[model samples]
Target: MTTEKCDITPNTIVGDLLRDYPELEDKLIEIAPVFNKLKNPVLRKTVAKVATLKQAAQIAGMPVAVLINKLREAVNMEQIQIEQDSEGKTIKPGWVDKGKIVIEYDASLDIENGLHPAAKVTKEITNLKEGEIYLLITPFLPAPLIKIVEEKGYKTYSEKLNENTWNTYIGKQ
Candidate 1:
């Protein structure tokens, strides 16, 4: 018999939710197809460790309240409605200029080779000059990295270039 109940909240860590309620993986993917990457053993072990539900929502391009309510709804929890704009951050980065200085790092190869691009990207983002842009190309959305750099004042725009390619633009507004 199943013992764990889905206890997802705004602050829930993505990996913890998956580990505690493994069945919820399907539920999450159903809500956002981009979550399909969570199936990969490597990414699930690495990325999810640092990603919170809030960051996951940002990566999915959904408001935090919306994502939390959807997740809670999926598992029969009561929805807690909050004002829409309370947790807004990256609705759209008006700073992106579509210019050059793109630092393309395809993290899939690094992960497969046992190297993590988070550290490297962190160092690169620290060195970014105003108006400079870094385009992180990865197999999945770099949610944790976005959170870290965004806290340091970088704005971003994320888009899927293809099924296997997600490009996130990180720059200052």
Candidate 2:
């Protein structure tokens, strides 16, 4: 009887191996969580619909810092859309569409207050919109706000920031 050892080192190129041996693709997919931490966005995105930096790090079996650095590189390079408000006043952190609302995380606000002021501000912005996609940007926002936005049929997107604080955008042209 002969026994062949399988190479399962973290450094192994799982994607290349799977590509060469198509049959192993299923097995690779089965253990996707392990490969996700490999700092490969192509692999990570293919496996998970929504992968956070922490989750990616766990999948690649690497430090969070390394995964974050890689994610930053993977983000779309296209310039974000900017537009003016009804008054034509410059809106800082403005989006391309007024229908799209963004809520930034703010650590300075008191958590005991039930809801972060930024979240409230975001809610108000959402109210102003007749019908538009709402996107949220923050290192971390109060959970209650997330539910409120969802209940209103607004789309939410969480963005990972370089720092711990949150920033909000009113309107900008």
Candidate 3:
């Protein structure tokens, strides 16, 4: 067994983790069947590189800490414990009224084309007027994208519409 060279944390990128420990692939899929998509070499290279364990956990509908600890254990690393935040209420916030949605971008097509939607989403987000909302429709919970826009001072709310559709509302604060 290889000595622990990398700390398996929520911020760890899936691709980087796999590169260091290819054996974790089955463990990831075991944690969530959704990870089976990683078997696709194209997605493995594209999405995995950009996706963090936190985002992967969100996509798997599991707690990020749980996912990280599981991966760590598989590699004989120390497990960590942290208070997991609630997934939040399903009730939409008052600022997220559908009528207030000024723009709607479905990023599933871009993802299918192996393109990241950050640039387009950021550009569209900048176009939002005060109190206006931009709706981003993606195939899964875009945790990293939400983090990016939120860091830029946008308020975001994500809701899973179905197994394959996630709606993320971005509002200018």
Per-model RMSD to reference: 6.0, 14.1, 4.8
| Model 2 ranges with Cα > 4 A deviation | 1-107, 110-115, 130-139, 166-173
User: Using Cα atoms with residue i matched to residue i, what is each candidate's TM-score against the true structure?
Assistant: 0.56, 0.29, 0.67
Off by over 4 Å in 3: 1-4, 86-119, 128-133, 142-159, 169-173
Per-model C-alpha lDDT, please? 0.76, 0.39, 0.85
True-vs-predicted CA distance for residue 75, candidate 1, Å: 6.3
Per-residue CA lDDT of model 3 for 1-173, tens digit only, reads 75765678877888889988999999999989999999999888778877878678767877778889889999888899755546522345779899999899999999999999999999889989999999999998886688789889999877777888999999988
Model 1 clashes, total count: 0
- Candidate 2 positional error at 124, Å: 0.6
lDDT for each residue of candidate 1 in 80-143, tens digit (9 for 90 to 100)? 8554555554344457666656566667888778886878988888777888888888876777
TM-score of 1: 0.56
lDDT tens string, model 2, 1-173? 75443232222234433433345434433434565243466643443323333333333444544433333333322232223345332233324454454433344545545555555545565554443333444444333354345455543433333455333233321
Kindly report which residue pairs in candidate 2 clash with one another.
36-59, 36-60, 37-59, 37-60, 38-60, 83-172, 91-171, 91-172, 105-166
Q: For each of the candidates, give the backbone clash count.
A: 0, 9, 0
